[model samples]
Target: MALTAYEQGLLAVQRREFAAAREQLESAGDDPRAVLLLGQLAGEGLGEPVDAAKKLSLYERAAELGSAEAAYNLGAAHANEQRYKVSLDWYRRGAELGQSGALRMIGVMYATGQGVEADDVEAERFLLAAAASGDHLASFDLGTLFAYQRQDPVMAAQWFLRAAKEGSAPAWRELELLVPRLRELPAGDTRARTMLGVILAFHLDERDAGAELLEVSVAEGDPEAQRSLAFLLHDNAGLPDDKARAMVLFRTAAEAGDGYGAYNLGVAASDPHEAVRWLRQAAEAGVPESYPQLADRLSELDVDEEALRWYVRGAEDGHKECMFAAACWYRDGFGGPVDLVQALRWYLSLLEVGSGDGIHEAHKIVSKMTDDQIHEAGRLAGQILAADVLVVSRRT
Candidate 1:
């Protein structure tokens, strides 16, 4: 028995014989599927010169012959050319034929106000309809809309999980970032709960799980992960003998110039000289907590000048406690001088961050300073807070 023209065309396409496929498809009379496939082959330049006009013609012919897929292709092509209104017409045709992709695009258009008014209600309706038919992109878009436009983290996590299970990588990544910010995980959703557990177990407080996740990074000589795993192991994650291995990891990380590793090694050092050396290196490497540790040690030894410098470093790095310490040092003349303006500046900065009871102390500084010095402190505080505000705005 011999195959029909349309069957022969499909077999040739599957066999990578584009020239043969096109010939057979062109002769597959009255078959809209054949015409649509021919248009796709032409658009993709499969054994033929790419022809946009020819592709559009064939798609229109196929759509006129009642092909829902051809209507979708027409809508997508017009969308690529930025003819939103025209694309909407074709998209509506596909939607009328119950095409999930067309429904998703119509929802997107509503969401973005492309060919119509930005209507969240309509967008949600269309998107939910598409999602009911198992469109993965519709699920992902729903997650994005909820997470960003609606400010609904719980709903966002639910949709992202659905898209991820449907194999959307972007949805998986978005879900991971959103999980930590969620105060409550979705109820009765094992997948969502599992994702939250995986994040907490792999990235946060579970020592054994953290070690498991960090194994490859540590083996590949990643100083940061190595240091982190070693720190957790040092806390004895149910293994007393792990302390010896933790020390070895700390040493390795320190040798690779990891600041936390140096800080940890310094904390465990018996000799004062070696401890001070490692602590200094940790401070110089810009470890935020190391500043307070090194500064407190210096202050205990009456090394006020060096202690003040370390405190200021931590304060400038946005550590709230260090900002308070720095302000106090300036106010009390512990490090250099009783510079009222500098003290007021640090106190105002601390107050802006809501970290210290700097208001009472600021009042003291205000009483001691001249009116001109008070103005200077206010301006300096504005400049400092402005930079922080810009950083926070970008993150949000």
Candidate 2:
């Protein structure tokens, strides 16, 4: 008995024979699974170099064959190209097929009025569906819309908590920032009090009053209050330095899922091994600041590959220092093969975003490249610019 084309293609994919899988899947024609596999192969360049136009065509065909993932891909490809109406149409189709990603995109479209009139009601409906299906970003947007647009801070906080529990760094930041705005509320809002106390103590330089307020908030059993008090006790000259108590509070805050707490613990740990563990935890929790810190430490420890990984994360999040570090790494082949094109790409990216400190280096690299390589680098840079890839992450 011979295997069917779909079955053969699937087996080939599992065996990492992408060329064979593409051939078999292409032969299977309109079979939904085959169409989807072929589209994915083209989109991801598994068998051949990526062909965006071919990938889009294949995805559209698969979508016509009723593949939800293909429909979602069509939406995403169109959205990336700023064809919002077409993207929204595809998103609606995928949403009809119960694709969570499609639902999320639809919600975003409605929220932002990309292709349709702004409709908060529709946005909420779709976002809620996506969130229920485990879309963390959808939940985050719901929190933002509720807080800012609907003026429902309590509901916004609730949604933000949902997003944070799902490991959303933006949602965590939103919740923290929302604290001070709640100050006008009754005094029973311990979280607000705790946050205000910390801000006053650490940020505004009202030390004595801040410490007093923090004590009251900590007494109310707020983990953030515990963390803030720990910072003050450790850093303030006027306050007694209680190392053991500070350590306990830091651990407590970290266990409560505060990335700052984890970061502080990572920085303060006497043992390098322990520090690495804490730093990794903080990085995984999406604290952008922690990426460079961990990368620097890893570089000091001679773990070049791990350090490069963290540097890449920081660079992706638009940290200038990390961007320069990553460019140097790519240029020198540190932790990986040297690729002049990739190095040039990073340098050009910095310049495109108005970081002229890299301009001289980029010019030097351009001089070293063949005209063809320079042209290719320029094309790559164009893609990055169109995609708005240079902006800082929510750390902004």
Candidate 3:
């Protein structure tokens, strides 16, 4: 009867009936499997808003009863909620019990100072444990840490290669970018083919090799690698810059929802008519870079209203250039009516982000205005610059 109840809950989950699944699973007793299923259902919100509290409760219960999956899930949920100290505790417990994912999470927390004081040596120790256990994600994290955080490119390359061999698509892509420098190393001899495969897949101008590697990765369901190779073949970035081929690759990557691929395709279209089409597609897909470029392109075409709208979008998306451009337009009435107050606000915002051009232009504009306006602008700029100086000092 209990098994039937659990099976029914699973079926309800499959059919997206969250309420029914939760009801059924709750009655399935304290079985670890049932609790895990219930927690996942609550966490994902198949039919309700995510109840993180409930999910955490269920996972904690199951974990206390010795379910490895539950322990890992509990730790992850805590980490996501930024309860880092609690997450570290759960992760350490799970890691001690031989959970590779937990070990990796602990490593990341130590490295990032999420809940604990950052300790690179401890992070590396935990990461090495996870890597030795064949955790591909852990290996990738370690590689990225060495490459970007620690500035140890040699160790970074080695960990990246290990992760790539373990089928980490991002690591493979990053390795493609790093391989040129890696080849200069004496130890690169043994990794020639793997490096070559990444190059052919992402950076080389040889379609045959790129296409072959792409096809293999695609068949193997490596989305990022497939997208990279497709881009190379389609843009002739790998072969000879063929627009037709690039369009095909762009279409494929776009369909698969690759954000950068969609943005690149939008940029490559060149036709103002098609620019809006691809740019809108990429923007809707959450590519922030697409908004500013689309605004600039529209401005070039003299489509002022559309351009201004996209500029606002770009500004909202935190593009410094777009903010400066929009501020100028507002100051001079280029696309819409002039509004000095709005222009000043936007310029000040841009200055906050360290846009020298925006700050200079804003100062020049204010200088020509009434003496009162000049004083106000100067005061605002001084405040912003003071804050920036404080931030820089803290970092140092």
Candidate 4:
């Protein structure tokens, strides 16, 4: 039997032949999966360049054919652009079909009152349902709701622990901060108990108790406790100075993949090169501030190539200042040969992000370019924009 156009489209998609996929999918006429796939390709900025209007049209058709994912995607698109009421409507449609992400988003809307009244009960109900359906965001949202809105530390701790088990870094961060309050809970949670003891000892001037508790936690390899103890020892506000031990603690935290710990180590490095080394580690570990700092330091040292590299890194991570700096470097030939096309690409990327004060500068550069060069710049800019969209969509 001849394969259906939809099946052919799927095969094309699997082979990364997006244009063929689009052609086959479009020919599949009224098939929900085909429409959905086409919508995703256009909307996601993945295989095809972004075409927001085309995406919406295809998604609408797919949703009309009972595609829950299409409904959810519409909800997400509107939500991202802050069209909350429209987002809520689309989310409700998906949620009615038992979509976990839609349910989770509806819970968030209730929690934040973005498109509805703030209702913790409703939020909890929807989030619990979504969580039960295997939505990790629901777990994180539950943690935030209990911790922040409800002010129920014990409940928050429970959800946060659940989220942490699912690899949530924010959950772990919250758990660390909530340590002091966790002491009010029963003694069953040993980690919380340990953290509370350390907090009391350090903050309440119970140095001996803090030290003992911290020693236990540190021995158990608690990175948060290690970081806290490092700061306490380094500051020596209420205890004896132990700079060497503090340094060791920082190293331990950095080695354990803690971004802030790496940042602290970078700040403490006496040698400029050593500082850059640590700062690079921090930046790569997801510390946003470290990117600009590293780039600035490299610039000061006249290491234009490395500075541009760092600036580009930060720019790709959505740092506006770094985007401008990178574009400037590209345009002025500071780091390498002047590449007006690449510079134009960065400048257009900045404008697309809705930040760049360099619009006039970009225009000036365009004025200097030939017609063909300007057209090439626009083409490169589209690629950059589409690539950025794909990155953000995947991450979110």
Best by TM-score: 2
Q: Write the per-residue lDDT of candidate 4 for residues 236-312, one digit (tens) a residue.
A: 75444487788889889888987777888888887788888888899888687788788887777788898888888
Estimate every model's Cα lDDT from 0 to 1.
0.76, 0.77, 0.70, 0.78
| Residue 91 lDDT, candidate 1, scale 0-100 | 90
User: Model 2 shows how many backbone clashes?
Assistant: 0
| Pairs of residues clashing in candidate 3 | 205-238, 234-245, 234-246, 235-246, 236-241
User: In lDDT terms, which candidate is top?
Assistant: 4
- Which regions of candidate 1 fall more than 4 Å away from where they truly are? 184-396
**Tens digit of per-residue lDDT, candidate 3, span 1-396:** 012466557656756677888898888887777788888877877677889788888888888877778888778777778888888888987887689988898899889998999988889999999887757699899988887778665577668877876678898677766666655655323333334455655444555775664565555544455456655555444455555655666666677877767777778877876877778788877678898888887777898887887787787666888878778888889778986655665677675677656655565555345533433443443333322332234346
Give RMSD to native, each candidate.
Answer: 24.6, 12.3, 18.9, 12.5
Cα lDDT of candidate 2 equals: 0.77
The list of candidate 4 runs beyond 4 A from truth reads: 1-58, 62-139, 142-181, 184-190, 193-216, 231-246, 297-306, 348-356, 370-396
Give the lowest summed-lDDT range of ten residues in model 1. 383-392
**Candidate 4: Cα lDDT at 205:** 67
Report how far residue 333 has shifted in candidate 4, in Å: 3.1
Report residue 28 deviation for candidate 2 (angstroms): 29
**Candidate 2 lDDT tens digits, 181-245:** 76666788776576567556754577787788878877787777888888878874554457667
